[model samples]
Target: MNPASRLAQISFTAGPAALLAGWFLLRPIHGEAEPGPWWTAGHLAWLAGFAMFGLMIFAMRGLAGPVRGGRRAAVEAATVVALLGVAANLAQLAIALHAGFTASDGEQMRALLSQARAYPGIELVVYTPGAQLFFFAVLAMAAVLALLRRVTTVSAGVTAAGVVLLGVATLQEGAGTALAAVGMAVMWLGTLLLGRGPSGDGLPATTPTRA
Candidate 1:
């Protein structure tokens, strides 16, 4: 693989690492009463992971270029857009949670939640449907990659399963979400596989051939 592809692979790996860290940090204290420093740390970790994943998604688009097929570019583009949208919402949520948790006491936290609820319109327009779209968009990318033989069949299947698990996570909370995080961690491996080129296109430090 070339330098760009090598970098892409590295970024892809980082994406999942960040996400897993975030989930680990956040899972314990999520929605718990008497939130503490760990709760804030968890949210920050999760959001940071999501932001890195967004960058990885963009990097993967370049790695995906060699594999040519029907609408490959379009699918990749849509995935970038959708994933960025997901990242944006994650940031928003993290901010809200941090603000709420930092409030002086219970009364202040409740007030913050109340004020946030007043803006349901934002969620309606963006986060609500956008997150669902992001899930399908990622699944679509996996399908396209599979069709193009850019990714292995098993990778595609795992990707699809991961997306579904994440979607299910949205509806429920607690253990189910943790399970979904595990599935997403698996999907990250699939993404790592996808980042590498079959032809060694992105390996670094190739010796030039003399004529």
Candidate 2:
């Protein structure tokens, strides 16, 4: 493939892999209220993951191929929503990184986190609904691509399942990180399969007409 296509494939594969790595790094400190080396490293990985996801969004649009009217609009809208979610995720990770850097102990870390959460809309936007949009958008895009026959149903379903698990993983504590890791692994697998290109692989058999 061309350089841009190659880059997209790389980002698609690496984004969730980074996320899984972050989850693994953070698992040991799941309930720990303290910020330290592990915390810094984990959040840094997450930051990179979300940033990569931002690029992956546009890559997904490219995968959707050229379209007009509603199809194009839907793809574009999904892209925007995914990007917004990625931005929110990045912001959250940034806050976590800052807390890791500034806080000295568990108590201090809790206090810092509490104070940050106290900011209006931060909880809902960065923590909940906003960050969640990314998953929703991804699932939607997968579904759209499936409907367009750009990707296999299995790929779309697997991606949707992974997204759901990742969402649920966020709500738990001790085992949540493990669940997240599994989810990321599943997502990586789906994306990897999706990257196989057309011809009964993952993508369509013929090159999509570029928009």
Candidate 3:
């Protein structure tokens, strides 16, 4: 195992776990009829696609460490997308809190929602972190998987999976619920991945190989 692998694994785990945990724990904000544990789990699985996205960025950076390559570019792109995700979720939460999701059905609630929805551009521009949070939730699965695959030949695919998560963040609506689920998967898997490694000073792989 090597130091770089350890850092990579840790970073991957942290990013995804933070994302998913935050999401499932707050699904009520999404106006879902039932936001129970089962629903949250299923949601987490779905969002895992996006949470895995950071891997594409980091993998490139990992493969091209200290040197800018596709990974560096990917990292840059993912950063922008991640920022949007954060912003979208925050904004949505603010709006929902202000309007009160509990009051969405009546005249007052409808009025507020209408105001926010009227100019869709306004919503997107300011963006709520909630939107991206949902997508990030499920990404955990990929991060953990990538860490597991670190010592194997399938790392490339795992890395690509991370990229896909990021890609969805960029192209889709500010879908925070999806991000949250994915992020959770990454967190659990990532922690396990870390535990599976050497020790606190452990490395993830014996040698770093090109994909």
Candidate 4:
């Protein structure tokens, strides 16, 4: 494969893996109100995960490359929505990390979460609509591209499957990390298929033109 394709595949694969790592690393800090120094490690792990996720977004943009007409417009608009959600999620995580590290006592951390939920702002917004939009927007884009035959069927199907896993993961307790990990793995496979040329793999990188 070309260097660009290699990079995109790596980014797409590593992004979710980083997130899974973060989740595992942060497990220790889950319910601990007065967490030890280990909490710092958890926070840092998540930060790295999110950063990698950002890189994944960049790589995804590269995959899309150039576009024209309605397809271009759709890709651009959906990308914006996904980016917004990513930004919001990062901001909320930053706030939580800040609170966790700086607060003198558990009371302070508790207050922060309480206030965040009480107010209509980043904290609540991030996990709610922001996260939802991030997943749904990507799903929508994949669906649209698949229907238009602009993207590989395998890529679209895997992404849509991942979306379902993520949606279910979000609702269940203690399932987020595992579900996300599996989902991302599926997406990685899809992305891998996308990067493969017809000569390298039987799968068509693009749908065949109908006569």
- Ten residues in sequence with the least summed lDDT for candidate 3: 150-159
Model 4 ranges off by over 4 Å: 1-7, 30-34, 104-107, 148-151, 174-181, 184-211
Q: What TM-score against the true fold does each predicted structure earn?
A: 0.74, 0.89, 0.42, 0.74
Assess each prediction's global lDDT (C-alpha) against the native.
Answer: 0.60, 0.80, 0.45, 0.62
Candidates sorted by TM-score, best first = 2, 1, 4, 3
Q: What would the TM-score be for candidate 2 when compared with the true structure?
A: 0.89
Using lDDT as the measure, what is the rank order of every candidate, best first?
2, 4, 1, 3
The deviation in Å at residue 69 for candidate 4 is: 2.0
RMSD of 3: 8.6
Clashing pairs in 2: 198-204, 199-205
Which candidate, 3 or 4, has the higher lDDT?
A: 4
**Which tens-of-lDDT digit does each residue in 1-211 have in candidate 1?**
6775555567656666766676676556564423566556766665665666666666645434543344666666767766856665684556556665677765676676556646756555445665466566667776765665555677678767766776677567642266768766876776666555334343222222221
Inter-residue clash pairs, candidate 4: none
Candidate with maximal lDDT: 2
| Residue ranges of candidate 3 with Cα displaced over 4 Å | 1-65, 101-107, 126-211
Whole-model lDDT, model 4: 0.62
* Per-residue error (Å), model 2, residue 137: 0.4
